[model samples]
Target: MVAWSVCAKRIALGGSRNWILLLVVFVVYTTWRETFPDAHSLKTITFMAKMKPQGANRPSQSIGHPKIVQDGYQKAILLSYMRGGTTFVGSTFERNKDIFYVFEPEWSLIFQTMNEYQPLQNVDGTFQDPVWIHDADETVERLIQNYLYCNISGIDVTSLRQRFMLEARYTKPLYDCVRMKRNKMANCVKNFTNVCTSKKFRFLKTVRLRVHAIEKLLTNDPSLRIIHMIRDPRGIAVSRQGWQEFYQAKMTFTFGRVCAEMLRDIESVEKLPPEVAKRVLPVLYEEVAENPESMVEHLYKFVQMPYTGYVREYVKNVTHAAKDNTVGFSTQRANSAKTAYSWRAKISWKLSSEIDAICERVYKKVGYLRAKSEQVLRNYNISLRDPHISGSYVDKFRQFRIPP
Candidate 1:
């Protein structure tokens, strides 16, 4: 039988007691606790900047639909947060600007789009005095180039890692800037409410990408379309593991680690306040590929893009790619109508029986499946509750608090 998707989280309140709740992610806890384990994230960040999109969200200019495309732009960054927001709805973009569908390269999108840029803010929540957020595109470009060389180039030396060591190194202006910012951290926090000072914050938050940063970008660039793509948990689990191998890194992608990262996205969606959720259009991998026309129609309206005949044709080819992606996987692809139960097939029957027994009821209640039997669900502590990955998804996750 196919199992359902349950986005498990890693960031618990204190990070231990309820470890069972996060067992799926905790598996990789020792190997990979935080998504990106670097200490650079220690830099303090303000919340306002976190409210916008990391990369520029202006509409595409090259998609042939001139009206929908924003004028005078080049590249744009996309936040494919977790499972659901990953759908390629943005792939059908018929704009002049090129749309690169980024699949969680961490904060690379923010750095790539207008690197070493600066931010400009105006009065009244509307941006006026504007500039690129990255301070120096060239410097960042170099960093990206060498980093990629060390990473994807498959070149010699592992010695190249030494070059990247200098990428984030402190140098006169950059070093002073980092230290200065560190010193005045509290003052910056106080200056956050002021719009003029607020724009400078783009740099602060970009250094650490957050959903709020995406939300802030949305506010500035109202025309950008946001599509949340979702895939089956099993497929994600398998795909991540595979990517880890392809890269051949010491700390490979663990099912638990990816699950922890995915939890953030799921929690973000379920926790969306009334307004933001409306702006976000959720499209499942299965739903979109299975019913392309209908899904595309809704996506166009959501992003305010025009559904031209050209757009429809492009969507067909993309869907074809999606269908082909499911092949060769050890587990069933997430797009099918069936539950992703095949994932359990890989585990020893003993473990599978326990997991299903423990998760079955809660799984079904969250729309993953219908209960095997009324009594079966109760036995698993599964009621009409939503088993989400985010702390936000749980009103009181410690207790079963489903919204009434």
Candidate 2:
């Protein structure tokens, strides 16, 4: 059976506690079998293995797509955190007329109905419930594979809520894909099958997935290329502070989680072997915004896409133009270049220092200079001693509550 169906079945059956325990053991064993006791991935090799006769829920080896023409279409992912320019980069991919792109399928509203499924906001490095953890892992793996293979149904963005979430963008292409592939039965099944076999460019943009999840994904599908997007932590902290959910938890806990994930993501890519390492391309938001023309061309080369005249035109006219990107649900916002480093002008020295204290190593590693100067620190201290200035700028994270 397809892996997602297996996960759905498990959730539907709602097995007893003991059954859940067994499932955890099975997931752990499978993860270990694929990753441990060896440097390479057995699971990925198995997927690439020659296929047997087709059966229900099994993918056929005879994917009818031609492999010789352009070395087969690519499967790419845009990996980043929320408010960290994911929408901006995903928009770049959307402008590619040939690509069928899905934005944050993992965070689709379809999964909101799953009772035991908790969102990324609640995941803090580990889960207290083992059953949910295992379930989450399997679901993520299935979603990643489904998108790579162009399983449209598995993309899970058909609902009205999902369309609204995407701000009605890309809906025409999404439905056109479904309409074009309808079979004699007037059903969507044939297109799903065709997409499975047909070679085409597919991209999945997500923010909720962690680095460990990405490692497991690579283990299962080595063909997938990752476009890891990073931003200045000061920018992230400043942007997140504007979000309503940022105040749901204390600043220390919320920002600490962000820093931890950022560190893990950077380290994960750094540790990959040469073969797998070549598949990852890290893009900085500031760099992309500052120099879209040069950066976009480099991205094309990195992803092995031709810098066609149309693509160049798109990058120059659409991607680089200043517009109100925050219109509807998008966050790219107006004046892209101006907004790239505007956090420096808005965020206070004390808050920037706190963000730097946690994100110093990652910021420098990613080519971002320190925003907090000694003079800024001195001014901040002088203000802190002044009751009037201190009251004007409330330091919510003054205590620096570190996560356990």
Candidate 3:
């Protein structure tokens, strides 16, 4: 009788353990089915799961981690204003096979927002005001964060259809897949995730976001870094004059707004904590064009990427390539340094002075010397950049006070 009682108790305990296991499996299967309703999505999830390290409880890096911990990869953003030579600077990363580069990922968001508002026009047919929404700042921040985290599936199909989204060399495969009639969009997104996660470095270049806007991302992701690119307002204004879309807009308003944004960005960087501040590196566009090799090396080091021989060769080829002026968006240049200052000769003395006055605070904050006279503006020998100006925000901010 005693032996039978012991056996009965053991059977009951084993049955309870089996019931618990079955319950857990049911919940997991049900959750996965609800989350990924399609077969392709289920396959993608399984593939991602298999790619993760053994015993890992977290989702794949493409889906994002709660906090970014470096797992043999780093993420970075090249932050700049429109026509601020972002294409030239971003090429340093884009040329490298080891880096996964996404160009102007924010364009989709910008496009969507712009569509909601009819562009206000002036009597002369130029746009009177910039097309923007009140919540655009927050929305742009979230979009950038999603891209950096490789949350490709979270992005809407409409956003993915933007022309600039297909411009990145790394995204070509996904772009091709998206165009196929039989291919599921989920599979295309899965392809993007696979390619993105396989790289040692993931990079994004954008002109839409502000410095303070990405503070949350910087604080949360230790592996993330920012390359803040600034160019002379005179040069930017001149460059915009060549582009019809911008030239149509009143030059004064466009130029003034650009400088205002630059000043605000400088202020935002100055207020960052030491830990967060150190991750931000300011790259002057003129300096980079002047010394491509050294600047590229410094940029790579700032982002913890290797400056390879191939990168050096690519820079040499692009900077030395025959100047292509036919295309407005061409990145090719015969003399990059010359191109940096070409705007000086293009703009009239009156225009240059007006721009200088408008961007005076920006020039002071960024350590750019204003062209005091027409002769000075036209003289190529005299450099407008202050040699003492380094990438240090504290040093730059020491000379000027923020206005009340």
lDDT of 3 at 36: 23
Q: What is the C-alpha lDDT profile of model 2 across 313-381, one tens digit per residue?
A: 666775445675544445444456767666666667777777777766665456555544846543422
- What lDDT tens digits, residue by residue, belong to model 1 across residues 18-50? 555556544654333232222122222223335
TM-score of each: 0.39, 0.62, 0.75
Which consecutive 10 residues in model 3 have the weakest lDDT in total? 116-125
Candidate 2 vs candidate 3, TM-score winner: 3
User: Which residue runs does candidate 1 get wrong by more than 4 Å?
Assistant: 1-88, 94-210, 219-225, 242-253, 269-273, 318-366, 369-404
Clashes of each: 44, 0, 0
What do the candidate models score in CA lDDT, each in turn? 0.35, 0.56, 0.73
Higher lDDT: candidate 2 or 3? 3
Off by over 4 Å in 2: 1-71, 109-131, 153-161, 164-199, 219-222, 243-249, 318-325, 328-335, 374-404
Q: What RMSD does each model have against the real structure?
A: 18.2, 15.4, 21.0
Cα lDDT of model 3 overall? 0.73
User: Number of the top candidate by lDDT?
Assistant: 3
